[model samples]
Target: MNDQYELLDSGNGKKLERYGDIILDRPCAQAVWAPRNPGLWETATASFDRVGGLNWEGRSKVSKAWNVEIAGVVMKLSATDFGHIGVFPETRSLWQWIRSALREQAQTKGRELKFLNLFAYSGGATLAAAQAGAQCCHLDASKGMVEWARENAKLNGLQDAPIRWIVDDVIKFLRREVKRGNRYDGILLDPPSFGRGKKGELYKIEDQLMTTLDLVHEVLSEDPAFVLLTSHTPGFSPIVLGNLLRQYHQSGTFECGEMLLTGKPGVNELPNGNWACWINTFS
Candidate 1:
């Protein structure tokens, strides 16, 4: 739990969160229960919804961009038109896990680890890996996001870290990596339900996730260290992600759980998404 961020309360299709000094009320389709502390929500600085198209009320109260440190990584946050605040707080745990995993592998191998991150929005995982002494390649379809990630790296004083920021389609990038004989010890992906590549290439998760995983396997090192998969799309449960990874590596240690937005005592932990990870014990 980071002091810079907190999930104050959530329910009735919305969530109240505090990032640094700003409190935001945002849509949470999965928060079907009733809010525990309705009084706390009035303190929110801003709120976003999609009733009459995507919009944010009290937008003037929020700065154009702000910073928050979560899981030991500094992230730049902004109220985007798509309702994202540049960082996914639920993934904070994943970043910590990645850092620990890579640190352990680096010690065992006695060398830097090569890590790959797909759909690496804002570069939280990439920074976590870099901080753990891994050479990281962060790829996202949006150039703006790549630039945003770079800024975040600079904010953390990791601008000089061994990181390759690229804006491209995930599948195309992986295919090229495979062709060039580029291999990674660890890989992470957080694909969106629907997205477009830099070149207007459409991506539908249901139709392409298997193909994406296949390409991911091709770029993995012979002694891969780990693979982490997370998603916010409905029905893509932790088991579904575990089953997908199982198709490629059947012997690794598998861990799966729901990604949650949590706060201090008395605040209900909200399930934001799901995650599945496979770690190579023999590596």
Candidate 2:
């Protein structure tokens, strides 16, 4: 985990954060509680205000673009129109989990694991897996994001690493991989609730999640290691993710929980998302 990124405060439908040297306040739908430390909000460098669209308020001494290292993965950050600073701090635990699993497998199994990352934005998980000695194929539908991920790879000095940056829809890529007889020992997914493919293919989480999981199961190696699935959709719960995993894998340790980040000012655990992960011990 990087010491630079911190959740300063969260409540009243917004979250205050420290990304490297920058302090930012952004809208958070899950922050339904009243703010405990309203005084700290005044000191924020900038804030994302949701009006007719999204807008940034206040002024920051920090650069509009910068870099930060999280879990040994260097990522570029920007105060985007989408209300994100290009890095998700709550995923620190998940990265650690994947690294530990890969390390253990490398030591005991004596094999370099292969990983597939779906909806791999900016390549954080891809970098983590590669650093853990896993060859990875990163898939996303956005070309700009793929290029940003490439820059991140270069920043980490992993330019020669076995990471395939693929700019394609996750479902389409998975189907193609299946046809090519390619499989992976580990899988990571962070599918958006609603999105459009490069070719304008509609993706609605409620309708496509299960079918996507089924496709994922098809491309998994026989002796699978891990499956980490996460969702930020409001209606999506840990139970839903767990049930989806159970539909494909019957016997594995399935741990389901809400991902949280502790805010500095109020020390409140802000729920960022939900996750369900499986570690296969049977095979």
Candidate 3:
């Protein structure tokens, strides 16, 4: 799948995006210390000035929903107060990768695959799995994100969908599911750089990811589909993620790869802020 990350222009700590007419003016820390160019900044439909809560400057009332063609898939996009596009186009590979992995796993195992997506922000992966006929569980820590996912599902006319939506910390939820004997054929995880649990529980990816992976393996069935982990932390590399998955692969029998990020025209080099691990059972 073609992950379209078009960097139209950037500068003054702000970036402009033209994703299917819903031009988004977002704050970007990377554009620090300089301006991208002289002209692109002027055409911005909106500029989210970052200070004391982001501010927007635009003429016409912009619609919240729009269709964006990325990697040949027509996924819907929207803006929210949280400053996150849950259905990030850069994640097109993830959606395609999961669906393909599940399909292959099912054919190999001669059985259906149950996919579980933890921290499933916005549900792109969940939607992809559901479309592939995989029983899916979509869990996230943010209720609003779940709602956004639901909207995406509904946009695809997937309302009353079979996918389960759970609002809970991913790690905590997995621990409970393990105790409840709930297992899945596949797992999708995109952990945060840092976060605090709903109950003051601290979560530091550097300190907790491996432990979390150990527990996640307990919830994967013997004949499994795959486990995919992606991170956008500054210091973590694809190798870091690959090595982590390696630690969990007792059999050393898994197909792994690097997540190559891309960008649009004369924009900039690939941003150094993401990593992914896609694991599949060889047998």
Report how far residue 107 has shifted in candidate 2, in Å. Answer: 1.8
| Candidate 2 lDDT (Cα, 0 to 1) | 0.85
Which number leads on lDDT? 1
Candidate 1 local lDDT, 1-283, one digit each (tens): 4548899999999999999899999999889999999999999999999998999999999999998998888898999888988999899989999999999988988778999999999999999999999999999999999999999999999999999999999999999999999999999999999999999999999999999999999999988899999999999999999999999886869999999999989999999899999999976
- The collision pairs in model 1 are none
Give the candidate number with the greatest TM-score.
1
Worst 10 residues of 2 by lDDT: 55-64
The window of 10 residues in a row where model 1 has the poorest summed lDDT is 1-10
Q: Which parts of model 1 are misplaced by more than 4 Å?
A: none
Residue 117 in candidate 2, Cα distance off native in Å: 0.5
TM-score for all models, in order of appearance? 0.98, 0.95, 0.84
lDDT string for model 2 (1-283, tens) is 5556678888888888877778888888889998777898888888888778877776455586899877667888887777776778888778778888887877777788999989988888888888899999988899999898898989889889999989888788889999999999999999999998878899999888887998999999988898989999987799988888888888879999998876465478889999998889886
Q: Which stretches of candidate 2 lie over 4 Å from their true place?
A: 264-266
Q: Distance from true position, residue 150, model 2, in Å?
A: 1.1
Alpha carbon lDDT at 64, candidate 2 = 69
